[model samples]
Each structure stands twice: as C-alpha cells, then as structure tokens.
Target: MKLLAGAMLSAILLYLVLLLIPGYPPVGEIPFYRDAGFSVIAHRGGRGLVPGNTIEAAENAVDIGSDIVEIDVHMTTDNVLVVRHDAVIDTTTNGSGAIANMELSDIQAYDAGFHEIDYPEASWEIPLTVPSLDSLFTALPNHRYLIELKPTTLPPADALCELILEHQLQNQVVVGSFHSSVLQYFRRSCPSIPTSLGKSEITLFVLLERIKLGHLFNSPGYSIQVPIKYKGFNILTPEFIILAHNLNMRVDVWTINDPKEMKVVSNWGVDGVITDRPDIAISLRERLSFL
Candidate 1:
C-alpha cells in the first residue's frame, strides 16, 4: 500500500510540473512579443533623428518602425491648415514671422531645414516648404497620425473636423490640443475621432474634470504631458492609473525620454507613451518584450 501511494504522488507532481512549464517558460526563452500591440509614437516625427514636423522627419520615423507619426498643425493666413510646431516660424524655420500672419505662398519661402543643424547626418538644406495638412495626409496614407492643433487664429475646429471627416480619416487619427477649449470644440464637433486632453498639470480635481468632460464629449483618452513628479502631490498617481483603467479611459503620457522611466511607466500599464526617441523606446520594448 505504501509503494502504491508513493507512485501516485510522483504522478501528481509530474502533472503539476507540466502545467507550470507551459505557463512560465524557462529563462532565455523567446516568447512571442509581437502579439502585444503597444504603440510607439514619434513625438514631432522623432526630433532626435531629423528636423521636427517635416515630411522627411515623418518618413524617417516610419522607417524606424514607429507605429505613429505625431505632427503639429497651424493655419496659414488664408486659413489653410499646415503642419508645423510653433505659432511662429522664427525658431523652426529661416522665416521670421508668425504662421498665422503668413500666406501659404509666404510660408513656402522659408527654409525649415536651415536650422536643423543638430542632425548633421540628415543633410537637410534651406528652402523647406511648409506642407499642407492635405499633402501630409496624401503622402502617408498608411501611417497613423497624432495631430496636435496649435493655438492659432485660422481654421476653426469645426472646419478642421469637416476636412478630417471628408478624408474618411476619422478612425485613423488622434487629435489633441493644449487649449482645452479647442479640444472641447473638437470633441463637440467630431465625435467619431478620438480626442486626447492635454494638460500641464494633473490633479485629482483635474482627473475628475477630465473624466467629467470626457464623458460629456465622449473622448476616448486623457493625456497628461507632465512628469511622474506630479504623480502624488498635484497630478494623477499610480492610483490614478488604476482609477483611469477602472473607468475604461486610456492614459497617455508625453515626451518621456528616459528608458528607466519608460520601463516604470510601461509597467504601470498605461495605454501608450509619446517619446522623442522612438528608436530607444523600441529597443527597450524589444529587450524587455514589453510589446
């Protein structure tokens, strides 16, 4: 009887090992990570690799395997929407005027590549023409876009929404703005596309406000651009991430560069991360098999 009992116990232990083996593979095992669809968004078309907000930059980001190319949008004097980062062209381009004050033709005269010396390998030259939103959309039809609406005087949110819907890109775009009022306008006008709320600070009050407003506008996600330093004191904490998850609202943090911080935040199970160096982010993700 004792010998029979020992054999039965050995059989039970072997079965348990077989069950655990499939769940937790041995170290150095290469589990399929591609099943996870975590996105790597290029912040301003990956400012680390090329001149920001330019077509070349966007292309480079795509070549580097970024899931989305983020761009900023402003309006020309004639109210034609164009892809650009700043309200003015003085810093990013050779032209020295406000984008809101210049005609599309006038904007075409500036050299966006002249000041892009930080990336010597890019070999970008002067006389970079500003690209219209339509042109960018046509150029990269396959790539997903994260469009940031700059605070400008021209092209009302309603009109922009019309154009976006006209192109049938309502499902492929994520729109955001620093101006809450502008985002609110977008939310009211374009209910089909997802809108992200950008805020400099995050608080429980702010999170509550975002949640309340999000429900009103039916926004899919809340975006916070600040650092983790804002987590406990003023902004949403890890607890907030938990809360957002419970509410079924996605959370996206912006412009995070540190790999360590990226790992930490990714572990928090946020929906996405916006970063300037997508290459580094991709490497980290690959190393850890996070995505």
Candidate 2:
C-alpha cells in the first residue's frame, strides 16, 4: 500500500510540474472576433419587446442598439431556411405544423407576429409572417447575426452555408446548434464562418475547466454561448471567462434579462450578453461606459 501510494504521489507531482511549466499554443483569432467587445446580443431579436424571431423584432433590436441580432433557423420542406425557435410552429405562429414538413409558402401563410402577450387583441389583419433567411440578409445587410440552427432530420447546414456564401456574410455571422453533429457538418461545409460551441463541446469544456485541464482543451468554436447557470450550477464565473480568453475563445452568456445579472456578468468581463431585452442591455452598456 505504501509503495502504491508513493507511485501515485510521484505521478501527481509530475503532472503538476508539466501543467505548470509547459506552454500551449494560443488559438488563432477568427474573423468574427475581430475588434469585438462587450456585445449586446438580442436573443430572438429582442423577444421580450416584440414577437420573437420576426423581422420586426430584429429591426427593433438593431434600432435599440444591439450589437448582434440573434435568431434561430429551421429548414422548410422545400429547403428554404426560415427564422423560428422551435422545430414546430405550434406555439409561436397562428397556424400549426412541423417546419421541416411544410413548404416555405405554406409556413408563411401563418402569422408569426401574433403574440398574445404583445397584442392582447391579436388580429389576423396584422399579419407578420415568417421571414426567409435570404430576406433577412437583404433587409439587414450591415448588421451582425448569431444564428442557432434547430435540430432536424432535414439537413440545413449545406443550404445555410450556400446562403451565407451567396450573401458574402462570412464575417457577419456566427452559426451555432445544440447538436454537435449539426455544428460539425456546418464547420466542415462552411469553413469560413465562425461558430459557437455546441452542447457536447460546452460540457467537455466545463469538465476540463473543473479538472484544471482547460489549457489542454482544443476548442473548435470561436465562442461559447451559455446560460448563467445550468441545472443550478453557476457556469459564468470570472475564472471561466478567463479560461476561455486564455484559449482565445469568446464567452457569451445567454438569455440574461435582469439588470443586476447583466451588470454582474459585464463586470466579470464577458465578451457578450445574449438577452431578450436589448433595450436594457444597451442602457446598461451606456451606464458602464462612463464609469
């Protein structure tokens, strides 16, 4: 037992020395991170203020001083990519069906802007249908976008990649997905575009950070878009943010709407705050700039 313990202790000492001495190569900066700062990313294009993922919400977010208009995309049956949060249109739109199973023309017949909360007396005449990715790019030519691809049986990466290339939006967009496979496909298909860490990659990063092996992690994404807490564990600490920076990766915390929490994370030196309230985030950024 003593001999085994001594051997284990020696191995641990060796690891500590190696960890403390060796220098790792810093990750190369991506085009998306060029001159980037504490960005105010409008989640679903400021969903709290307008109908989520609609063109109006996107315009509102940009006009209110958001640095990035975040949106979600799902491919239609006819291979057109539409802006939406869910795989199905049941919750957000007037008509209902799976996005992948319906053609774009069929899908747009439903009013996506008919939010009961925003419009208590929702009218069919006030029809703001789902906008195509192509239309959005045409409308917001100079804006930055963070697009999350919803997981689906119909592969959307190739279509999305072609569109980005067609629009010459390589530098203005960061693509992300909850499914790592989808992100992998996108990365392979669209090498010029930057991407946020997928769910599995995020899990791997957290695990490595906890074990003090963060420096050894070779991240494939340009940034990580995470919630402040996941399953009750705080994920956005100063240490976590530093580790990401050390790896040359940007850290973007998501869905933060509270003024206090936004201030807290901004103070911690996060690269971006993804919020449904860009108005609040922009206001906070202005207040902090003077300090």
Candidate 3:
C-alpha cells in the first residue's frame, strides 16, 4: 500500500510540472496573423463559391477580404508539400489514388476544380489546378495561411517548416493539425511558428472547461480553433472565450457560414470565424462595424 501511494504521488507531481510548462516561442520576424480579434478566416479557401484548396479559391478568398485563408497540406509521394485537403484524391479531383502514393506532377495534373460542379454560377475562368504549397504562397505572398498538417497522409513538420523558410512565410502561416504528434513536431522544429491546439489538447481543454478548472494548465498552443458545437454542446460560449483570453490565448471557431450563426459567435467574443463564405461574413462584419 505504501509503494502504490508513493507511485501515485510521483505521477501527480509529474503532471503538475508538465502543466506549468509554456508553449514554444513563436518564430517570425513579421507579425502576420498575430491578431485574432473579430477576424474572418476563409475555410478551404472559402470553398462554397469556388473549388476548395485551389489557387483560384485562395485568390477569391483574398479578393473577398478574408483575414486568413485556411489550407490543408499533404505531401506527395515525391515528398512535395502540396495544398490539398484529403489523403485520397478520388473525392475532390478527377483522378483516383491516395495523395501519399501519387507524385506532385501527376497530382497537379488532375482537375482539382471538378468540385465546382456544385456551383454553376461561379465561372471557372482559370484552370483550377491542385496547387503546390509553393504555388499557393507565390499566388498570395502577402496573405496569411492557416495550414493544417496531415502527417498521417504525409510527413508535415520538416517539409512544412522548410517551405515556410523558403517562402519566408513562417510569420504569415498558422500551422494546425488534429494530431498532437504533428503539432509537436512543428513545435519542436519551428517553435516560432504559431499553431492551434491539437485534438487531444482541445479535448482536455473542453473537459477542464466543463468542470471550470481550465486555468490550471498552461495552453499547449498559441491559439484554439474549434467548431461552434461539439457533440451538440455549444462550446464557443462567451464564458469559454473569457477563459481563453484570460490565459492570453486567442479563440477562433471554424466552419461557420450562416449569417445568423456568424452574428451569434461574433457576439460571443470569439477572436475569429472560419467560414466557407467569407464574403457574407465580411459583409456582415462591415455592416455591423464589428471589426
């Protein structure tokens, strides 16, 4: 009984020490994406009006005045980091293969704009090609990118950091991933780059928030990005925003497109909104002078 008690005490001490550790220091000379206040983030490059994750969609998002363009990164078989949302190309493109098994040249050759079938009114003036991360950065060098790493589909940290360096975009990009390992990899190698809370990290945050004990642990990431609802529970409450801000962390919600819903969260004091319709959100913010 004494031995077991001692082990438990040791575990508790270790956990407490871990909780007090701070997040990695940010890595940019430029203060791009430094603010999280009442901003509009284009989801999948604001895909409702254009094909998702294409350069055209990115251009459209910038033209529409979104504060950030959220793009997913998947490495090709040839080890090129490309802007794509899926591990498999069959759903969003004309081709049929896992992105992990395809070369960059072949993946780029596929008609990425095929998803535009859903939007007949939006003209595909330029060929919608699957853009490499380099291409996307080149297309919108001045804009911010919220790049989600799909390390399970492709190696993310090393390649992603390299690209950020090559493009001088470490400050302009916010790296996030559902997987903790991917975020950890980035944090270790590129601690200066800002990142969102990983899935497990946010899960723990939700639990602590539920019990009103969230202030106990230091945040693992610089920011938190969540959907408005989780398991039907409204997670982006005003109180939740207060808790995050108290910790000096920014809170951003994702995938919100409805104008009414957008207004609701905006009122909740969220730092930003990620949406498939940045145009509508931008207009609403403008009309209300919310920004």
For all predictions, the C-alpha RMSD in Å is: 14.5, 2.7, 4.6
* Superposed Cα RMSD, model 1: 14.5
Per-residue alpha-carbon lDDT of model 1 for 159-248, expressed as tens digits? 678778878887677777777667766777777777665552233325544443322222234333445655454343576566554444
- Tens digit per residue, CA lDDT, model 2, 1-291: 999999999999987985786546666887777887789999988888887788888998999889999999999989899998888888768788998899999999988866554333334345788889999999998899999989644368888889999999999999999999889888987888888899999998898788787877788888999998999998878889988999888999988989998888888889888988888888988877721
The TM-score measured for candidate 2 stands at 0.91
TM-score of each: 0.75, 0.91, 0.86
TM-score of candidate 1 versus the correct structure, residues matched by position: 0.75
Segments in model 3 whose C-alpha atoms lie over 4 Å from true places: 1-30, 33-36, 116-126
Cα misplacement distance, residue 112 of candidate 2 (Å): 0.7
Error of 1 at 101 (Å): 0.7
> What is model 3's C-alpha RMSD?
4.6
Give lDDT per model, in order: 0.68, 0.85, 0.80
lDDT for each residue of candidate 3 in 164-261, tens digit (9 for 90 to 100): 98888877888899989878878888876778889998888777777656766457676789998888987777878887777767788988888998
Clashing pairs in 1: 202-235
| Window of ten residues with lowest summed lDDT in model 3 | 21-30
Best by TM-score: 2
lDDT of 3: 0.80
Report lDDT (Cα) of residue 247, candidate 2: 84
